[model samples]
Target chain A: MTDPQRIWTAAAVIIGDEILSGRTHDKNIAQIATWLQVQGIRLTEVRVIADDMDAIAEAVNTLRAKHDYLFTTGGIGPTHDDITVDAVAAALGIEVIIHPEARAMLEDYYETRGGLNEGRLRMARVPAGSDLIPNRYTGAPGIRLGNLFLMAGVPHITAGMLDGLTGELEGGAPLLSEVIGSWVPESEVAILLRDVEQAHEGCQIGSYPFFREGRSGANFVIRSTDPDVLQSCVDTLCEGLGELGWDFTPGGI
Target chain B: MTDPQRIWTAAAVIIGDEILSGRTHDKNIAQIATWLQVQGIRLTEVRVIADDMDAIAEAVNTLRAKHDYLFTTGGIGPTHDDITVDAVAAALGIEVIIHPEARAMLEDYYETRGGLNEGRLRMARVPAGSDLIPNRYTGAPGIRLGNLFLMAGVPHITAGMLDGLTGELEGGAPLLSEVIGSWVPESEVAILLRDVEQAHEGCQIGSYPFFREGRSGANFVIRSTDPDVLQSCVDTLCEGLGELGWDFTPGGI
Candidate 1:
């Protein structure tokens, strides 16, 4: 039987030297994770490797073997460092060639601006048996091979490509979450929290310990699919905290 | 022969339900990466696992085996959901009991507030043979076991602990990077860029493709330990970009 809310796992491979050098703070991993969570697809791991062919290929194969889907970002451009397609082909034991559609896009991109340069032709080289992922941001398209969606590293371009393909893919129902805010410290209310968690077998509870000035506190979020069960737990929690003169509000689903 | 600058490969194991659920975006990885880079330590991998005991234990054992140093964040709070200490003990095949030092800190934290609750006592549990990592933010001290640095998930607190320990750890010299920026499209300036890279054997060069208005461009950064080599490469890059009629600038160190 097929589960509608099936949690599919993904391994995101971020290829770039900039991220490693701390020149670029990566925005893709968090963006992708948020998108996947809404679809009930779990981003299991994220690997940020350099533009080296060996490193990219090694991480590609390793991630592909462990995950249901492998999403790679970066190294698909008109330059020497843009070797993602070549590296992916090497990892998949396939040939690298320009697809008819990609060639057309490349020709159109260059012709629209006058003529094609030899360097511009390099962006058309894609892994064999791959489908073109439309890039609305720029003319250089993304590629999809099996479960791997090879995207551009630039945040806007990557976002555009992902948005374009969202409607075509099979995804899970979005997971819902609920949270309760409080000003009670974790240390002051530890046992009551533990008992609440043990009593609610269906929900997953988390404590976020925070501090304002010298005063310490926590925000406890109880998560579950059943809204009724979640509310009941929250009610009990509020009562427990109220008795101790602790500040808390309705939270979690 | 021992290298003058010790570069220990480190893996960060982030244990939290909030991070996994997409409720919180991680600030620790970037902060830690910056800290380690400055200290000459390399962060090779990062794994964000849930608060499940099995998952935490598995990640701890796996990471500790591969990397020279393993830094874990989250699940060290006083709450029952905070299972890092016990999980680390289970992973290392050791016992977890109330460490005298941890207990003393807890006693002080509670005694200052009149008297201690049983829930507060849970914070004292530590894996056998591990030394305490003094926390300057709050009294709840972190622990260190061999290469493993158990730390708080809170950004400010985690940074404080890492900062305190930085002077003691051996590290490589901070990597230097020189960014040569240009507004020309990547395709237009690919050949000369490749020539510049081929000429600079000592430096590592990268292209950061970006788009402004309707035109696309790239920022080429040359990185190396040798200042002369880096400057030479930067000069070649500026000359190349200048030939393309793109505005060039020396961005950073």
Candidate 2:
């Protein structure tokens, strides 16, 4: 919020073995990428590290230094493999101790169903000088230290924390996008595109070609914040492409 | 193939609107990652870039420079959304031309059918100075320039090209691994792991913790080529963990 014009960049460190081993398909990275894009935050790089202390430490240090924000998902649960808290603390040169607020939340969540033991209370560990990113779905609140936000790997829980974080933080303009698609060969219009791109200096243009076994076509997308510029570019590009024997339309299979 | 000691690394660049929109679940990245890992190749990075030219170009250039091999899946189809070839060509600073060999293959594939047109021939456009990575599933061959390998986004076709590429190249020693799992708390056994890591200099040790509802456990994996060192580390780590009221056994979910 300090500098309103500054572009926000983020990097994700997906820490788990289930992802690397192909045993569990990860939903966090893609979900986070989509969410961040909408907020005008660029997700520059993502590293999928196995649950290793050294590996986690290395990634945390590198990512935390490079990106504006570093979000680590997984390894926050109260399991034996959940060492992200300790590793992150080590990376930041801080001490991780059980926070009183987190402990109270865990205790309150467990009180309805008997109570939680010392092992279950492991979720209360927080690195020194960190604030809890309140988790709306469960008692295990995500912890944030400096620019690094550590949240649960579960899709619902991570999403819950993201909602809370998005409301508090400032972001850039949301990216605007529009798609124009049709069944046309990419070759015939390849040269014409070189000129369109040169002309549109502000917009980000994307052309995608597809094939469904027996059928073939291509899609052209114009993405920019300026609505007038986007509409004009899409219109002219479509007309130019249509003149070159392309079936330019709003949508295609 | 020149340096046998050099480990092979590949990055997956997934280009598609379907993937980004969550319309289609991606199976290609995991499939390729797992296959390459078994072959002693490390897949460290994966990028999902939309059908945008600038995005694709930027990702292509970065990944091509960083990794030993770059594997791109998607955006090479015959539909309107497939712009992978042209973008890749632009990224490599080459002209997108219809290669004689690629044309011949596509021609042969559709010789019996009449739907093949100048539009369908778009699949034949290959970047200059690139080898064709044969697609066993479809006649559409993937392009390989320098260390960058461009293949279809479809899981079957990507897997086919990957299989063919693996056979053609020579690689370093295959990575070997052993898992030491237990249903115990990590904090109580952290000291023992520190000792085991200190003793095992060569092996890359990793620990993962998981929990289902209230049940929790962790798996410690020691990966290295040296069988003796791996065995010794696994034995010591597992035995030490057992001393802390942990029950570790192989493949015990």
**Candidate of highest lDDT:** 1
Error of 2 at A208 (Å): 8.8
lDDT of 1 by residue, A1-253 (tens): 6686466787788888777656687788777777777656777677677788897898899889988888899999888788899999998999999788888888887887656787788888888899999999677899998889999999888888888777666665555556777877778888888888788767667888888877766788886656777777777888898998987766521
lDDT of 2: 0.75
Best by TM-score: 1
Q: Write the per-residue lDDT of candidate 1 for residues B215-236, one digit (tens) a residue.
A: 6657888877677888888998
Question: Which DockQ values do the candidates obtain, in the order shown?
Answer: 0.52, 0.19
Q: Quantify how close model 1 is to the true structure by its C-alpha RMSD in Å.
A: 2.8
Query: What residue runs in model 1 are displaced by over 4 Å at the alpha carbon?
Result: A113-115, A251-253, B5-7, B113-115, B213-215
Q: Per-residue CA lDDT of candidate 2, range A173-224, in tens?
A: 6556777777764544655655675677666655655666666666666766
Badly placed stretches (over 4 Å) of model 2 are A1-11, A15-24, A34-70, A74-129, A135-141, A145-148, A154-157, A163-166, A171-253, B1-6, B21-23, B79-81, B112-114
Instruction: Note the chain A TM-score of all models in turn.
Output: 0.87, 0.90
The sequence of per-residue lDDT tens digits that candidate 2 reaches over residues B1-253 is 3675577777778787556544456787688778877777777667666687887998899878977888888878664457889998998889988888988998887776544575558888888888898987656789988788889887877888888887565556766788877776453465576678778886766555566668656667777767888888888887787676677887544
Q: Pick by DockQ: which candidate is best?
A: 1
Instruction: Compute each candidate's TM-score over C-alphas.
Output: 0.90, 0.72
Candidate 2: docking tier: incorrect
